[model samples]
Target: MREEFGSGAAGGAAAGAGERGPVVVALSGGADSLALAAAAAYVGERDGFAAAAVVVDHGLQAGSDRVAERAASQARGLGLEPVLVRRVAVRESSEAGGPEAAARDARYAALARAAREIGAAVILTAHTRDDQAEQVLLGIARGSGARSLSGVPPRRELGDGLVVLRPFVRADPSITRAVTEAACREAGLDAWRDPQNADPAFARARVRASVLPLLERELGPGVAAALARTADLAREDAEAFDAMVAEQIEEIVEHAEAGIAVSVAALAANPAALRHRIIRRVAEAEFGRELSREHTLAIAALVTHWRGQGPVEVPGITVSRAGGRIEFARRTGSPRRRRGCADGDRAEGGGARGVAGTPEAMEE
Candidate 1:
């Protein structure tokens, strides 16, 4: 791992404290996460803090409970004191889309629930540099602007009473795996690997096994590192842009029955880039889903080409033009929003790809 990249090496970075509650570590039985749980233990030991591990079994496949149980045992061995493992039923709700996204959402919800139960401040996840880079790529492929390109945040507010932290966003997954392997060897334990990683049924799998490897071979050995660095830079810039947008929203956003309504007239007056960002921002708040380019364009069309009182529905949400402004609200407004345009939890997957900082000592 590069020294310039903080938190790249095992147990290398200092603890970041900000709006932290009951620290809940999300352990997925993957090397990236196992190492994170162990690191949390180390941090807890050093900081006089007692941490708990939360493992969510999504029931996506058979033998999942066995995996979750193994993760709980590992967390206990790592000195988490009492690791709490729970299995959540993945219903085919908007929140839990397919097997992959459903599992992720359920896991996060379980962690948040546990955090609330314990009054924890921060929920830590082991989203590595590689993951961040892949996210950036996904975001780019989806044509999300700079905000989407920024990738994963190191720390940000999640649900109430909890701010998610990715201390290892700059860390190399290879390094995390190495650390986990070392721990496994020393403890005479087995580390679990997700078979889906090589299943090739998902976009991420293709990116990992084919696209990224090709990029690395054709571009250079440190292509993933470069992508991650780009994401870091993008993240910084995107955050700044979002801050500015928030300030602008105050001037143009009006409270409405749906949610926050945007002044289309005021929006038209802004710069083109700001216009697109504002569109994305408003959609983000309203639907909480990743609105695609087509969706944004449809909204923009109302400003440019629509006559009067025509209903426009985007995936997950609806936009109505009355007077001279655009209103963004959930389509169903059925109290519970379905994922799509209205369900923002799914988010924009391809926001940024995380690159590995450099895992240690690899054997062919």
Candidate 2:
């Protein structure tokens, strides 16, 4: 536990200007998060960085406010200054996968807000290797591509000059739980377990409770570690491809009247993977729509397998090719929806207001 805490304490201090402000921890009252808050507070005191904790009450279940208060109390006991408890509304939906994603997006937004209010440059989260493994398994099951397989990133810029850090992404959940419990005991703090985590209605809960255990039994030990390793390798591959795509995009795409255009010749010259991504990027940027893989391949066919196929209608937009260019424009008379995808995390548009982070790796 001490060693794990030391590892977190050593990693967060960045060089130069970004290290000047406070470091904020998103405390969810779980063992992982409680450990993170305690470690961050300890690191701040020893290393001369200001530290605070924010507890976001999702208000999804009964007595959520009490949970938040308990978490805030724990944070205060840990010597985290300016501990805050924020209440957030989690949007509900009958659509599959919508509710979970909405809660994740809302939690991140609240964390970002808390960081801004405290003038903090970095916000730390407590996602362990177990979480990463489950995320990877889910991504694989969905066939969402390597981006989804990459799982939660260790660090990401959340705009407003703030960065979110997942310090325990590489750490084992069991080790984190033990470490957090030890730290809480030492500090005389009690951690609260959210009942939702055990609810079978949630896909993640089922994955954690059943699917992973089955995999472990069938595949032997270290399955979770292997999955986390796979995510790291996939992330590296995705980053390289993203760099290549960024380099090729500007030369191949242009803004046209009431729509955005991409050169068919340039797209055809690239590999299918690159072309498919280009098509999706253009659609997402101009039309504010996330194209399904099938839709993306269909659009790429206009270049690779041109058969004079007419414009295809995607969620909020129409895609067509004319004069050696593929164009995406909003569908006429369509009502404007919120600027996010069905999954809720990926921003629909390319502008700054769009959600921060990478595009969704898979479509519904």
The prediction achieving the highest TM-score against the true structure is: 2
Please, what are the lDDT tens digits per residue for candidate 2 over residues 12-69?
Answer: 5332114558888888898878878877776666667777899998888889899989
**TM-score of structure candidate 2:** 0.86
Q: Estimate each model's TM-score.
A: 0.76, 0.86
Q: For candidate 2, what's the RMSD? A: 6.3
Candidate 1, residues 1-364, lDDT tens digits: the string is 1222223432332343323433678888887677677777666666566677888888887999999999999888887755888889876553334456556666777888887887677777877777766767766665656665777777777756467777777554543334556654655556688898887777777777898779888988877677778888888887788888899988999888876688878878777667777888887775676556656676787877777735566556767787877887676632233445344432322222121111110000
**lDDT against the true structure, each candidate:** 0.67, 0.73
Least accurate 10 contiguous residues by lDDT in model 2: 355-364
Candidate 1 Cα deviation (angstroms), residue 227? 1.0
Off by over 4 Å in 1: 1-22, 171-189, 255-265, 286-290, 301-364
The C-alpha RMSD in Å for every predicted model, in order, reads 7.8, 6.3
